[model samples]
Target: MSTNVLPLSKPVPADSSLRLVPDVPDFVVGPGLSPEVADVVTLIGGSATAGRNLAETRRIFTQVRRALGPTVPDIASIREEVINTPAGKLNLRLYRPSFGFRPLPALLFFHGGGWTVGDLDSHDTLCRQLAIATGHVIVAVDYRLAPENPWPAPIEDGWEALRWLSNYAPLLAIDPLAIGVAGDSAGGNIAAVLALKARDEGGPALKGQVLIYPCTDLSASLPSHFAHADGYLLTRKQYLAYVANYLAGQDVEQDWRVSPLRAARFDGLPPTVIITAGFDPLLDEGRAYAGRLAAAGVPVIHRSYADMVHGFITMGGRLPAANRAIADIGRALASHDIYAFSDGGGI
Candidate 1:
């Protein structure tokens, strides 16, 4: 580990309010962040979504995610399928584990790119790894992206995919009863919403939900939004831009469907595994969401990677913790005995 402390510079876009370390005079690098990630941060500099319009931002994001993503591991089998929804054709990729039993438990994964950029290919490697680690089938949903198919469109696609998967579980040898939802970032937001929706609809009961550094609150007023906003890969400017693009000029920040943290109740939701990054902007809200779920009597397991940042889960190639986190998430998804664990706070 490098004992070297990098100096902080003013954030790009001339935003004086954005602080790398809130209320702290001296800004040091790798406070708790691993040296591997810190070196990558220095190499990458700032957000790829910075200073670009929607089209360019999307292109850059796609490129960066692919280039920095972990090495793809070979899985048992991968097949593509399409579900015809009222909105349109929703594409999905199913990954079967090499060693899981017949009718294996499955996880429906949503890719993260703020809801604007990512697609099936962006998260292909991660899903493959998840399937292998958990010994469960992994269904990767290639939902519609934003600024094109904005709010509720991705959700609609996600919900329809779940329904379709449940209805046709036998076709793919999936255990309908053992189905769960998992996603990172914006996809995490969708997974959280879908868990609630499934509970309310009273069918297709989910086994669990894995939320990886999810942006639970669109309000974006949490303290972490400013505390670790600038130096990390995900900048505040980019975060708001993603939200705006998803909203598509609509004022729906308070909508529970858009922000699951705003939901009136969290009870009866599936057992949840919430992964939070200490240096990510969404840290506070992710913790708050876990607390809310626990308070409502839902079984929740909250894991905080105190040295990581937002979107670190996708950069497993550059950071060893990301790969370890993926395996940890796999155990959470695979375990049926997860309710035995506490939410750490005993809330």
Candidate 2:
């Protein structure tokens, strides 16, 4: 809520564990794509086609993501529950890793769909994989989508879910002090906002955050937005449409919750890991956010997959980079000392 934007600084060096694929030449439409991803994109028409109404757009995206066949890890258990919130009941899917103790660290995950299309089922595979790789409890929040729920509604649901996890840690078999947030795209926006809210409200201290290709700046004028706006899984038109649907006539471009990069201060945030794909329209903002966080003295690790496109994380079944990225995320979480073990537990 501070109006004073944090001063920008020189780029932070990439984390040692961060991998950078070589950049492809400008002549290429989607440079450096793995064969699997390239084939998938080619089959689906590299960019989201324009002129579809909201319903049609949602249907197309849903079908396309379903076709990706995300990798499903063999977790110990999965359960469904709902968190009671002031606004309404929000659905949640809980995932337990195959090899972790009762009081394990937990991640409250939000899935990406431009905040319109994704659901618990859409991201089921990714959540399971994360639970297994990180050895942490994964709570996938099916937050309300935009144009219907819109703006503060999704944000509110995210906060409520995080609070519920922290408050009911014992019932959930999680360590309250070891919980964090993770999300991709629109979901990433929610996770970032939750981190800000927690810092301001002074409770539910988070261990860390993992934001994958997050839409950090809703204003959306970054260089990458123009440079890689087309021929990537997520296109410029789609990006604008998603924002318009999400904003629903309210003007909150300057609001920190909507645009965390515009926030006045970034201090006191948890340690963080931010991942950005080279061909993602959201790439520059994600990188800028990492720089801002580092400038404010928050411990930050930034990983850039220079050869990939946005939404690659959800294509792990085909993209080796996606699986590798998941593994890197696990290592980052563990290195932060967020995971916990009971007396008889083993890694």
Candidate 3:
């Protein structure tokens, strides 16, 4: 990995799609968020590359969660239970908006913790914001973390969750047709793979898929790995280290679930939205996936946040530009009629 950090001010298109959040206003983020979360985030961000292997990585991440405390969002309803699946029991948290729910679009969310850490608690605010902004039923999937469960475990949980969601629609009060999958970083990898799996297997098709600064490739050869390898929040050394543990001698570089960019066929996938952070280490791969989706004739809309770093979407409620993304997703959902689509009907 290169020691140089790509300056956020580097040349890019002059459109509003490019964003940098720390430069934006402070209102997007609200009060009530504990300061302890900030300190914990810094610790994990710094700990990114310190883990010698998966075991050590899991130990450090467990410590990080202890430091971060728990979810503090008012609207976020944290359900800490295990859902029985064909593969095994998986953990999940379902976040419902303040609005009364008859039936609404459901977004199965995967929290980003490098596939090592992160749970429903860590992503409380983001899920609340998504529920409010998109007016949808957001079910955040708390799949077993890596090194503990590894690649196929997380991937299998994700796919089963989707099937379970479809199979148990009445229990969830979700419009089966209006269902979609979303996540950031490692979660995004799951979302991309889920979208592909549904299309290939003739499973319940998603209305739309949202990927926020997704890590689409695991080979560690993308340019952003070197271009923004240091001092930009997400370091390349930290990235490779996390994957090394999460993968742990598993062959994931070619697995479509681990690296959605490697999927051979992309046609017939749902209309999609791809969000990219300009200074993010995964920028190139995210954009490339969007391009591939477009090339494959999938209706796709791509946005590049020029000034933001990786994980800005999770911070949208705090930064002005991030708030815009929240609203953008809402409007897109409105068009998709996320609440109205049903598998038996049209999604």
Candidate 4:
């Protein structure tokens, strides 16, 4: 971390306003935020909900999410393909950072929209930036959404996508043993679940997992949930709404797949990077999950952006901190020995 702290300079857009709640703790206020992040928070106005129906809400959420950041340009190439899965044909966008003769490490990415919204396009720029920064082939999964496909459907899609990537490594020009899973928010939940599933299923061993402000608990009753719930970009109301739509009619609260923090065991999982925003409602749970992973002897790098709010990772173009966070994620991935040959041998 650098000693220099950049101060906010640009004037906030007239439509935006800082929506900090009264009586916030000094810790929550900590250091002043980057000007760009402050501007985004102002635009968000502390709530992301916009419509009465799921469709309208999704539309609004996607629009807001895209508007928060600028699109990154010039990746080596992007390829779109469909993979057959138990749920359906899953759409995937492959981002190649650079052309190379040897197989490269890869990350199977899931985009965040509370599992109710978000698509490959919504996260396209971020994925490309990450791919370029990390020198990894990034595969963005377009999993089915909620209030429709629901809980286990998305989970299954994520696991299936991971399996596909590992099984078809030669065709994709990726190292089967070097594949990892990553996502933000709901997508993070999916990535975490997929890691667990992979461990239990005993195949396609994951090299690592990068979870950005993941929702580890579906109960949504943590102290952080109530403390920083409203003013953060992701509010308690929006959290509840997404979960309601996702788990509607399902009673899998205690199921580890649905709420990973509730899992009885975290042993034998791959090395992990868990990132959490200081003011996110899901902060405590993410931290708790990291502790659990470490206790279970899994190598874990837990990072918390104490002065930032939820979804900061997606605001790289706007927030310098977000760019730094992305670099941190890249460095974490690079530090691991992902190039080690799998027992199955070279492709």
TM-score of each: 0.85, 0.86, 0.78, 0.87
lDDT for 309 (candidate 1) = 83
Candidate 4 per-residue C-alpha lDDT over 89-174 given as tens digits, one digit per residue, 9 for 90 to 100: 99888887877677878989999988888887678768877887788888999999987888888988888888889888778778
- All candidates' lDDT scores? 0.78, 0.78, 0.69, 0.78
| Root-mean-square deviation of every model | 9.4, 10.3, 10.7, 7.0
After superposing candidate 4, which stretches have Cα over 4 Å from the reference?
1-36, 340-347
Q: Which has the better TM-score: candidate 2, or candidate 3?
A: 2
Q: Rate residue 135 of model 1 by lDDT.
A: 70
TM-score of candidate 4 against the unseen true structure: 0.87
Against the true structure, candidate 1 reaches a TM-score of: 0.85
Instruction: Give the better candidate number (1 or 3) by TM-score.
Output: 1
**Candidate 3 lDDT, 1-347, residue by residue in tens:** 11111112112222433232222221122122234223222323454455355565455444343333223245534444468987677876676564443566678888787887777655666777787777666788878876667878888888888888888766666677778889888888889999999999897878888888888998878898787776455777778877976898987688887788999988988877778877678999999999999999988778787766666665433345666776777777666554453443222
Better of 2 and 4 by TM-score: 4
The all-Cα superposition gives candidate 3 an RMSD in Å to the true structure of 10.7
Which regions of candidate 1 deviate over 4 angstroms? 1-32, 50-55, 99-101, 334-347
Alpha-carbon lDDT of model 4: 0.78
